[model samples]
Structure formats: structure tokens, C-alpha cells
Target: MNYIALSYWHLAIASILILANGMISLWFRLGLEKTLAINVVRMLVQLSLIGFVLKFIFVQTSPLWTIALAVIMVLVAGREVAARLTTRLAGWWSYGIGTTTMFFISISTTLLAVAFVISPEPWFAPRYVLPLLGMVLGNTLSGISLGLETLITTLKRERTAIEARIALGHRRFEAIEQPVRQSLKTGMMPIINAMAASGIVSLPGMMTGQIMAGADPVEATKYQILIMFLIGGATATGTLLAVIASAFRLTDERARLRLDRLENAGSKNV
Candidate 1:
């Protein structure tokens, strides 16, 4: 079967499902109408804009365009990860930690996949690199955000215990070791669960899309499996790096807990 193209009318018909959601919010007096409406508009606009932007880039052969988009994606992901944190390292450190780790992990993994695994003619081909980069970056951003949040929140809640450990001659790493481990685990759990449930309980988006596009099921599964493994490795490495970097920022040379270094971030009245 050939791939089917969706039109505006088709999109409108599909949106009826969201009305059901809006109805539930009304039934429960949940007052989610405004939020849902705003979010729907945001999603539509963002997705539409990207669709056009991608269409334009698809015809271009320049590696520069692909690289430029990759950089923008990283910066945006970095800001988003920082913004999602209830508490984060103050100033640029909040953005720096997540963005830096994600940039290295996601880009390197995508490059490796495109150059070695996929091996398309022009290695920097947008068709291959951008999707791989986007997937890896999105997953890595989640991992880094969760890991950073876990580290900062744990430090605040365990200030007394961490300090006591410090007084007992434990280094900063020793004092916060448990939180670090738990943070890495928390950061990695979503991907772990998804991988576990992938073939059994659900089909991943990439696999589904490929099959819909007429690729053989076996080939599609292979691609999805490759992407999943790359995402898993990137997520793990990015989470570890971001968590460790943020932990260092929240401690000092004297092995003291430095909760003062963190500040609540996100949209709020200053």
C-alpha cells in the first residue's frame, strides 16, 4: 500500500478526539479548557511550522543547513531541560549542564549512526542525520532534565544528612553518592520501560511510521531497534554527565552542601 497524505479536513476530523478530553475536564470542573486550548494551538502551530521548514530543507543538499538546524535544536533542548527543573543551578549553569551534555552525547551518537550505521552517500544528509539527531536529542534532554532535577531536589531535602556525611570526612562524591545513583536510575527508567514494552505492548513511532511508508516490517524493525539502542546509550551518558556536573555545582571545595547555589527556575514572578 502506498503512503496516504493527510489534508486539513482530515486533521480537523481527527481533532474531534480532543473534544472528548475537553468534555471530561468540564464534567469534573477541572478548568482545563484554557490550558488545553492553548496547548492544542501551540502544538498545531509548532508542528505546522516544522513541516514547512522540513519540506524546504529536504530539497537542499548543503550540510550547513543540517548542521545549523542541529545547533538550534540543541540550544532549544538545553533551555527546555533547564526550564523544566523545579530547582536548578543558578545562572547559566542550569542551561549549561543540560545543553552541553546533550550536545555531545546526541550529536556524537547521531554522527556515528549516520556515518557508520546508515552510511548514506553524503554522510551529513538531512534525511538521515536530522531525524537521528532529533530523536536522540529529545530523549537525552528528558534524561538530563530528570537527572538534574533529581540531584538538585535530593540535595535540598537531604541537606542535614549530606552535611553530616561531610562532617564524618566523606568527600562530596561520597556524601551524595546515593542520590547520584538514584538520579541516574530515575533518568534512565523511562527509556528502560519503553524498551521493555516496545515489541510486546507497543510499537514505537519510528517503526510504525516506516511500516506505514511501505518499508518491509523486518527492515523497519531493524531501524527501530538501532534507533532505540542509540537513544538508550545517549540518554544514559547524558544523564550521568549532567547529573555529575550539577552535583559538583551544588557542592564546594570544603565538601559543604551549597543549596544556596541553586535557584528555582521556570515561569514565575520574580
Candidate 2:
């Protein structure tokens, strides 16, 4: 079987769904019509650009270009993680932590997958490396962002409770243990739920794409399972790192809560 090509008319016709969604939002006074429209446009433009760029990079097949693109993806994901936080640590700490955690876990997982699991030719093949890195980084980005935000918000909301624990001789880590655990759990929930519902509720993107491209169903499913496991591990590692780092940032060496380190959520500037 051959993959069917979608033409301009096909895309234009498909876009009607988005327009209908926007219209529905407007009709209900949901205030999301503008956002929906803008997001649709952005998604179209970004995906188109990336499609062309990936084609070019795949043809070139240079590790340097592949690594550079991977770095760019991680950096952008890191920035997104930091931006999503309602309250953030002073200076570049928040952004740095996010970037570091994402880079470490995503890259490590990608390398392991490429080197040991998939083992594509050249090991750093643009086609395999880029997509795998993107998938891992994308999932990690969401997990880390959620974990960081949860930790920051919980620390601020429960500052008094945490301080009381500290005053009662509980270590800083002990005081914030529950919040940290909760944050990690919250961060991992999306991936976990997706895993649980994957085959039963809906098909995953990778498997769907592969099947559409005429791959064997069993082969596609095997690949999807591997990818899911990789994503889960990456998300868990990244979320743990982000939550723990944020927790430490929220306290001092003296085991006192350092809510001062956090900027107000609605503050104009950091």
C-alpha cells in the first residue's frame, strides 16, 4: 500500500473543523475563538516549516545539523517549562533548572533508544534521532512544567505548614516531602493515563502513522510500546528532577522556607 498525499484542497477542506470549533466557541461566548484561530494558524505554519526543514535535514544527514536541531528543541522546551510556572525562582535559576533537567533526561533517553533499542545506521541518523528526541523532549517538557508549577504553587500555599514542620525539627526535605511527591504524581499523571488508555480508548500517533504508511500492525504496535515506555521513563526522570530542584530552591541551607526566592505569579517582571 502507498501513502496518500494530501493536497491544498484537502487541507483547506480539513480546516473547516477548526473554523467550526471557533464558531462554536464564539456562539457560546467561550472567549476562546481568538485563541483557537490563532493556535490553528500557528500550528499550520509551524508544522509546515518543520516539515520542510526536516526534509532538508534528512537529505543532508549530518550529525552536526541533527544535534543542533535537537539542542534547539530542548532549549525551546525548557523555556516553555519556565514560562508555564506561575511563580518562579529568582534570576535564571528556574529556566536553568528546567533546561538542565530536560536536556539530561531527554538526551539520555534518546541516546539509549538510538544506541541500544533502535540502533539505526550511523547511530545519530537525523530521521531516527530527531523524532525520538522530539518525542521524549516533548513529553518531558510537559511533565517537568507541571511538576515545577505544582511544587512552586504548593510551596507558596502551604508555606506556614511547611515552616511549622521545620520548626518542629523536621528536615526541610521531610517538611516538603508530601508536596514534592504530589507534584511528581501530578506531573506523571498525563503520561500514565495515556498509557492506560492507549490501545483501549484510542490509537497513539506513532502507531497510527506507521499503520497509515502500510507497516504491519504488529510491528507498529511493538514500536509504539517501546516508544511509550521510553517516554514514560523520560517523563518520570524529568519530573522528579524538576520537582526536587524547585523544592530545594524554595528553602535555605538553614532549613527555613525561602518564599522570598519566588516572584509573585502576576508580577510584571521577574
Candidate 3:
């Protein structure tokens, strides 16, 4: 395949948003002055490296490498979930919840589709499996993050009310019902809406990529619809479970509030 180098104008046009985001972060007092710079640098470096790594992986065409890359993404995503929600929770439990839920959802969806629907050659093909898993995990990661944030903030803000509810004869789940459900719903709404408005409001990335690669639009849309439905299922499951898990971090063995726990749980393990 012939490659075309981007001209200076093209490069500037591409980077406009990066420059704008950094400027806005500074101007609006986002308190991410350093973070903005770091993120920009990380994005540039990581994407550049990922481009080469992906090329190598595709050429190597080893199932091991493909699976390893998928595992790495899951681990990284797991770390983010743990760091964002409850840092002191210890090893592999976060990995358990994050990666397990992700794999469960992705595999289940893919198998159901492959068995009953599109039976592609080598159903576990790296190209198909990796991207499908990425889509599920990517959305689920955001959902998990939102769920954790909601749970933490809710517990913090309603500490007194939650304590009172506990005293008034309510189980932990019953007491935290409203907040937990709200968080789950809030976390999953974006994915739900994306599904609802997919064809009308936007050309989804997967479909667009497939069409750009010269696949039939009809075939591309079929894959896009399948992935979205599967992702929705994954998001709902992951978000609900993550919120429930986060709630445990805020309560103790006696099922009582542990407000002080939040302080130690905010550290990023990275």
C-alpha cells in the first residue's frame, strides 16, 4: 500500500483541537495545567507507538500477540477503574471485576452472533476479536469510571442521610438503592443514546472504518449494529456491577458507613 505524508497544513489542522483543549484547560482554570501538557505528550507518543505496534502485530499475525495486546488493554483499564474508585482495595480484585465482566460480555455477544448470525472464517480471528473487544471494553471503561465517580460522590454527599437510613432499619442495598440505580443509569446512558441515535445522528466509527476500507455499506452497518447492541449489554452489566462494587468500599463489615475510607482510596496506583 502506498502511503501519503501529511503536509504542514494538514498537520496544523489536525492539531487544532489539541491546542484548543490545552488552551481552554488553562483559561478555564481546569487545574490541569500540567495534566494537559502530559496528556498531549502521552497521546502523541502513545498513538505514534501504537501505530507501529499495530503494524507489527498485524504482520506477525500471531494469536498470542493479539490475545496479549487485548489482555494488556484490559489490565490497563482495570488499573484505571481501581485508581478512580478505591485504590486500597488490593490487587487483582479490580482486575477480576473489570476484565471478567469485559470478557464475559464480549465473548458472549460474539459467540451468540457467530453461532446464530455471521459465521466468519475463524470466528476468533484476531482482527475481528480485538476490535470487537476494544469497543466493548472502551465503552465499559467509561461506564465503569462514571459509576465509580457517582458512587463516591454520592456516598460523600449523603453520608449523613445514608447513616440515618441504616439506623432506621434498612439493608445496605436498600439504603443505597436510589443512588446506586441512579449511578448505573447515568453511567449507561451515553452508550444507550449512541445506540438509539446511531444511524440518524452519526456515522459510527466502526462502520465508517469498514466502509472506508471498501466494505459494502450494508455489511458495515450489520457489524456496527451488532457491536452496538453487544456494547450496550456490556455497559449495563459492567456499570451496575462496578457501582455495586464501589458501594462495598464505602461500607464496612457491619454494613456501616466508612467515610474515612475515601481519603485512602483516591490514590492512583499507576
Candidate 4:
């Protein structure tokens, strides 16, 4: 398969669409032009930097570098998960739960895939591990953010009913059981819908990228299938961990509701 080369000039041309969107934003008084511009720049800088970093890592093929980068990515992603919460837990708990979940789920799942499934020359191959880890973490992060947000927001809204349940002899987990279930459902819905729509409604990003880069369609599909399953599994597990941990944090050994653990929902610290 032949690969077509793209230069920086091509990217400049492609960026015209973003410029047009910014223009439209300004014209419509959408107040999104500045945001659009800033985000475009951020995307360029971040992607460019990562490209260089990945190049260096791939050349070195060092487990140490790969593991270090993975840790950094997990920490950054964890902080981002916390930032997405409208009502976050006070202090480090806001980010700690999600971060820990992402690290365990993403790293473990990626390693299992690389070791048993793909089994690249080196199990810790940066090229395979980093991208797979990124995808797993990204999906897991989404599910967790949604689950935690829904759980927290719902707890605040349904505080009275939950407390009533508690007063009526229900345990902490029992009182908030409905909201927890709802949160889990909300968190898993995206991957569920995605799985449903993957072949017919859309081609997944990884599959599409593989095809574009001249991989055999069926081969790309097999990889995509593996990825989807991994993502679904990771997302569900991570979301469950985050929601359950949060629930525990929201209650004490005495089984009392502890809303004090949460920061204000409206005043986003980010």
C-alpha cells in the first residue's frame, strides 16, 4: 500500500474550516469565537508536542519512558475528569477516584491486549501500548465523568428522598441505590450506543484511520472490534469504581448522607 504524504501546507489549508467557523461564531454573536480560536491553537500545540514526544519515544523504545509517559497521561486525564464535575468532591478525592480507576483499568486492559492478543515483539512496545492506553483511558474517562457527574448531581437533587429512605431504615447504599443505578446506566449508554452504531451508522475513528492508512479493511475491523470490547469493558468497570467509591465517600460508617464532601455544583473551580 502506498501512503500519501502531507506537509504542513496541507494542514494550513485544512485549518480554513476552523477559521470559517470562528467567523460564523463572531457574526452570529454566539460568543464562541474566542473559545474556538483558543481551542484550535491549543489543539495544534498539544497535538504537535505529542507528535514529537511520540516520535522520540518510538525511537528510544524504552520501557522506562513509556511507563513514565503513561503515568503522566493518567494524572492529567484524572485532573480533567475532576474538572468536568460540576459538583466535585472536596480536596483530592475529586480527582483521585477517577485517576485511580483510569490508571488501573487503562493500563491493565492495555497490557492484557498487548500481551495476549497482539503480542508485539516487546509487550511494552511504546507504539502499541501508548495508543491503546490512550483509547482505553479516553473512553473510560468519558464514562467515569458522566457517571460521577450524574451521581453527584442526582444526589443533590434527590437529597430529601434519599434521607427519607435513610430515616425509614434504609442503609446509605440502599438510600442512594436508585441514583447509583441511574448513574451507571447513563455512563454506559455512550459505548452501548456506539457499539450498536459502529458498522451501520458509522465507522469508528480507529477503524477509519486504519483504512485511510491503507490497512486491509477486514484487518482494521478485527482491531476495531477488539478495541470496542476493551473500551466497553474498561468504561463500565471504571465508571462502576468511580460511582461506588463516590457513594462510599458520600456516606459515613454511621450510614449518614454526607453532602459536605462535595464542592458547590455551580461554582466550577476549573
Worst 10 residues of 2 by lDDT: 261-270
Residue-level lDDT of model 1, residues 16-99, one tens digit each, is 999998999999999999989998998899889988877788799688888898899999899889888988787889888878
- List per-candidate RMSD values in Å: 2.0, 1.8, 3.1, 1.9
List candidate 1 segments past 4 Å from native: 20-35, 267-270
Better of 3 and 4 by TM-score: 4
In model 4, which runs have C-alpha deviations exceeding 4 angstroms?
A: 19-34, 265-270
Give residue 153's lDDT in candidate 1 (0 to 100). Answer: 79
TM-score versus the correct structure, for each prediction: 0.93, 0.93, 0.85, 0.93
RMSD in Å for model 3:
3.1
Tens digits of per-residue lDDT, candidate 2, 1-270, equal: 799988999999887877788788889999998878787888889899999999999999999999889999989888888777878887788889999999999999999998889999998899899988888998998999888888888888888899899999999799999889989999999999999999999899989999999999999999999999999999999999888888888887889898888875546443
By summed lDDT, the worst window of 10 consecutive residues in model 1 runs over: 261-270
Clashes of each: 0, 0, 0, 0
Cα lDDT computed for each candidate against the true fold: 0.88, 0.89, 0.74, 0.91
Clashing pairs in 1: none
lDDT of 3 at 2: 32
Model 3 Cα shift for residue 28 (angstroms): 2.9
- Residue-level lDDT for 41 in candidate 2: 82
